[model samples]
Target: MGSTSSGRSTGARDRDGEGRARNARPRDGLGRPLPYEAQGVARQPEGIVRTPEQSVAEAQGLLDAGRPFHAHEVFEDAWKSGPQEERELWRGLAQVAVGLTHAARGNVTGGARLLRRGAGGVEQWAAQSGRQRPYGMDLVGLVAWGRGLADDVEAGGGTVDAQARAPRLRGQVP
Candidate 1:
């Protein structure tokens, strides 16, 4: 009864009991919304608190699996729950994941811009905090990776293989 002429639901959007909008829509690997009836990759739950090590591990796995959007969500959780001093680190990592998602999804301009922005944010945070390898992350390597991927995406003007371009969260310093 809540369906529109197109046979899609037309009432209030899916929501939790608290009345907050919940997107029940399925999503592709890149996090693009799919039709309600279409199957989707499992979504990472929101707002869970995890230790820095756990966050890094989980996000790295997702990135390596070519699920950068999921990796972004994992980083988002850390950004929201981590200590104030580490918020920028997590936020920047999330942005880098999303940048990869954009590049994989064929948004070349947006992908390149976000990659650079995220790399710059990470670099700035490391300079300000002087914790280049917090929680075993190789900030310098990740920044260089993100920036280099951005350059490649821009030059190609096309989609990229997200897994192939995924950055190693832990890598040799320098």
Candidate 2:
């Protein structure tokens, strides 16, 4: 259910015709915003726009769908476009996806280290952004789960408890 059939259609229509109708913003086939339009951060001369929030949400959706490597790539692309303030935040998030990707592959030690670095960077970025930090399950929760996995690996733990964890945490494994 990560992908919706109407996403592209709605996004295109929203971009090409009705711009002021929706609050959720338009998205591309990949679920990322087209640029400048989604957030309505700035006015443009009539074209598609994608916002950081949309891009992050798309990446999060991919991560939730068991695609952290893809999520890492998406966030990396978003990060490369510099706004100075949000740039580092995207970078940290991209790293978080990478860390989660590693953890999913059972590389516990590497995942833990990357998670630590990402956590530090994202926490700083979140504070600076002054935006309520993204939902904890996305990044913070991943770091904790990665840590738990690392601890389990160190102590020779068993399979992670799917039922015991939240849905968002599921992204950490796959």
Candidate 3:
């Protein structure tokens, strides 16, 4: 690394062909950037469109694997690609996933705040849409779970077990 005249290190930044800054760094399960030479978990490709069922399944799988950061990306895709009216729902889900990621990464304050915000977003969306079980998701239950997790994380004041605390997106399975 070379130092610039302004005393900043002149490290090469990852950029796309168009000169847009795009970080190509490998990331850990919680989305923390790793050293360039370190092997990391494969990242979720962005902007892929999927059916609602597919989105739920994929995000749920990531969540189960304790990769809430990746799960958040899946939900972000849904928020971008899904119907406009449902954007809030997907965005809220993404926020909840990110909250879990923060919790797992030991940022208790950020984790709790995001969780509460996400839960509130989803709860309000559900109330307005009157679709409590959209795409097999139990919105009411998810809201309660997210809020409860927020409270617990704040109370505990430490990193949470992401896998142990993963939310059940749907209601009881048969």
Which pairs clash (backbone N, Cα, C closer than 3 Å) in model 1? none
Residue 82 of model 1 has an lDDT of: 88
> lDDT (0-100) at residue 78 of candidate 2?
71
| Local distance difference test, each candidate | 0.92, 0.55, 0.92
Please give, for residues 1-174, the per-residue lDDT of candidate 3 as tens digits: 996564545796778788989788789888999876679999999889999999999999999999999999999999999999999999999999999999999999999999999999999999999889999999888999999999999999999999889988996456
Cα RMSD (Å) per model? 2.3, 12.6, 3.4
TM-score of 1: 0.94
How would the candidate models be sorted by TM-score, starting from the highest?
Answer: 1, 3, 2
The local distance difference test score of model 1 is 0.92
- Provide the lDDT at 157 for model 3: 95
Model 2, span 7-78: residue lDDT tens = 444334332344555434543322334443444322112222347666656666675666665677776777
Better of 1 and 2 by TM-score: 1
| TM-scores of the candidates in the order shown | 0.94, 0.53, 0.92
RMSD of 2: 12.6
